[model samples]
Target: MKNIRNFCIIAHIDHGKSTLADRLLEFTKTVQVTGGQMLDNMDLEKERGITIKSHAIQMEHEYKGEKYVLNLIDTPGHVDFSYEVSRSIAACEGALLIVDATQGVQAQTISNLYMAIDHDLEIIPIVNKCDMDSAMPEEVEDEIIDLLGCERSEIIRASGKTGLGVEEILSAVIERVPHPVGDEEAPLQALIFDSVYNTFRGVIAYFKIVNGVLRSGDEVKFFNTGKEYEADEIGVLKMDLSPRKELRTGDVGYIISGIKTSKEVKVGDTITHIDRPCSKAISGFEEVKPMVFAGVYPIDASDFEDLRSSLEKLQLNDASLTFQPESSLALGFGFRCGFLGLLHMEIIQERLDREFDMDVITTVPNVSYRIYDKQGGMTEVHNPGGMPEPTLIERIEEPFISASIITDTSFIGPIMTLCLGKRGELEKQNYISGNRVEIQFKMPLGEIVIDFYDKLKSISKGYASFDYHQDSYRPSKLVKLDILLNGESVDALSTLTHVDNAYDMGRRMCEKLKELIPRQQFDIAIQAAIGAKIIARETIKAVRKDVTAKCYGGDISRKRKLLEKQKKGKKRMKQIGNVEVPQKAFLAVLKLD
Candidate 1:
């Protein structure tokens, strides 16, 4: 335990967290350094240049002829995956706070720093990307000092691309970061930080030993599920799973117990020996709160059961995803899935196609609302279909968030305009340094669910960083907007919006849908409505085949007769025609910009 150092890397998006991790691994010679970002093993992560999942690996480093075991967990830097960062911080005693030299302290850097401070983890600040020609090491060093309140000499300037100061970082981890403290004589207690599923091997749970020792072939039970199983295989996480006879206290490792169902193993649950269990389970683990809600339906109705099982397996890998069975009149049987953010939802949709070979349709995303009836009964509504009638409702309250945005001084005017258009109120603004400013706003969560982040980036020319947290709910005048195709309402196309912007939003949605939905044999009327009143409408003209071509040289009456017969046939087809809403139409609401 004295030689073990367990720590994680935390930073904002594209701030060299993964790159710095690769350099650390190369210096330790833990694995062959044939490629960049060896920790990000997922193909989706590599293609997108983002870390979607947190990866854990063990490394051996020697300092002054003394060997040390370093357990490093590389975490995603996006705001959508902050839960990953929190879980990694819980299992370690320290963190490496990496900041880019060109881009000074940003929003996620401050948010992650506060999370580490709450857990009482020792923070070793580093100024990364110092080798770039455009690097502002002096100014960034000042910003780090302002944020962390640490001396200038404590911050190390390193470049992940050039491997500069890699040795110094390893030395800091050995000297500054504290080793894990646990008793080997106590009962077995290990915290499961993360897990993954295997078709051949069942569920593999990665955990950190907090007390006692866990040996192979021992009977253990999950604290949350209370299911017992024999440990078939136990090993530590290197590049691959390295089998071990036993794992003692302060060690990070994985256990395979032949558990077939993913539900049997839960993240943040404790694992203990069935005979001599701990008196209590581990605490300080909070359930994740999903901010965005959307319905995910299979392309084929018979695939509903298959989709459910696939989601169950996916949930084991991503604990932040939550879902419940639901049915839609337009989309048939589906599940109302909750996601951390828009990007998280997109990644899940792609994974369902790539990993599980499931073609699914996702509806427009929205935030949960608190609806109160006239009799003083309150119910939480996640979808527009769940909302009660307006006559029976007393008032509706929507979720709000306190958003922090950091950007250059030049983009403040445009950003404020964009936020105000969404009914955001300016709370406070502080100047971090010479020209970098942090603006705080109190905005409704529903306003930013779709394209707010994208617009912010474009408006700031990719210099703005945004972060937000849930705040108190406030009463507002909100109405449910429904989309109708050929006079029939589609429940999956309904949404809740503020009354102030409802008219404009309805018009935009109608126009966008008209462009996406294909033209059929009969005219299609796309209408957006609130109750019985139609606020906006568009028509998609029919694809016509000339019935009068055969009467080209005939008399005028013959040509008229042919046209009349064609019109009657078209009228009949319009009555029985069913318009199929394409998958792109369902996602059109997201690109309403």
Candidate 2:
């Protein structure tokens, strides 16, 4: 049997997971052999400094006369992609738990480590970014030993950015990480951990061989569903940067089983021999669900088709992205999309802009809300634009989330006050990694799912980290504050707010909406209303009269033309009876900025 080592790199966001993968790719001679360039091939990946999706690559390296095929998976760091990270961990026998040398252990690091431990994978702790001026290897090593209970000397210090300790880290993988120990001659069983598309060859299903040899042209069945297909091509990932034929048991390879689309190959599905099919599939595969929702609309209506095509291609690569067509009275046509979290949202948006080159209008993000009615009917609404009438909602509750914030002790007070201000209920407080403190709070899921991360970073000067999960549905006296331009509801100005803050929030919304819309041909009334009550009001002054009653010397036809122009301009005014609305009124209500 070939010596195989499967491992993943885990770290908090911006902690250098991709950089480490690049170094490993270089050291194993995979880049030289395959002629693959640096890892950040996608413009978005390089620009963002984060890995939005989990990616795996293979390398063949000889250590101490032992030839080992190292399968390394680089995982996403944000909490939104935690499910993906967990799956990557499960696909491996060990993981390099990367902790930033200068920043020490962040909350995401701890969360990902726990996930790795839960998967029963061996942990090879690695301290990265040792080249940073603030890096304190001794303190960081001590913290890792104390917090994670790992041997002090076992933590390998490396600068992934500088290619330091790359060879040593690979050697340690051979010594510390266990080789795959499953039988190769038993019923052919393989676990499909990831899948992608090859433009000319169709879907390339990546799987780890568990039992029995799988050669090209063999018939295989997905054990979970008993679906069968003949292998069109079977291959290992070559340094040439693509799949090469003839993969066998115990090796990580791709199966081009005439699976034309990636949709047929799911992560965690078991590929087995048709004649001697395995009796069981791999355990511990969880379906990833999205937690954030937003409305995505094209800047131009003609690009709607382009948007759909782009989304489809993106979904082919990322299974977690979800979307559905939605239209609003304000936004003519758009989509209500669900994502794993904020990072996922940003990634998708960035892809749309960068890859597709499509300009889009995005709505303020909202979490899934639970609607309770007196008639015993219940429903979940992910977009505010989809909310039912107030009369239909006898009682409404929004999802609450449990959030953990890690920061230095000095910022605790400011952070606490901000949380309290946002209606977060304190759960507990504790110290982690010595001087760093973690504060747990129960917050309205909607509050933290939006710009909370950016605001937290701004408040903490980029020193704080936050992560959250849905807790439960809690009763909330909430109202949809709608702003009216003229007499019609300006759909873009609507916001879901607690009843207590309706007046103040409405005023702020109306003021902002007024600023966004341009001065109209006529004066207009911009008012925020809660049922029959007007909570706040603003005005858009009307354009001055264009034509005056005057006698023309010898230009009677010119005067008539001027009068016709004035009439047309008056009709262009957004008016509700005596009120005239400006062009800016509509735009102002739609965007908070």
Instruction: Assess every candidate by TM-score.
Output: 0.95, 0.86
**Candidate 1 TM-score versus the reference:** 0.95
Model 2 residue 579 CA deviation in Å: 15
- The parts of candidate 2 lying over 4 Å away from their true place are 32-37, 223-226, 239-241, 298-309, 332-334, 356-360, 406-408, 460-467, 518-525, 539-568, 575-593
Highest lDDT: which candidate? 1
User: Candidate 2: worst 10 consecutive residues by lDDT?
Assistant: 579-588
Query: What are the candidates' C-alpha RMSDs?
Result: 2.0, 4.3
lDDT of each: 0.92, 0.77
RMSD (CA, angstroms), candidate 2:
4.3
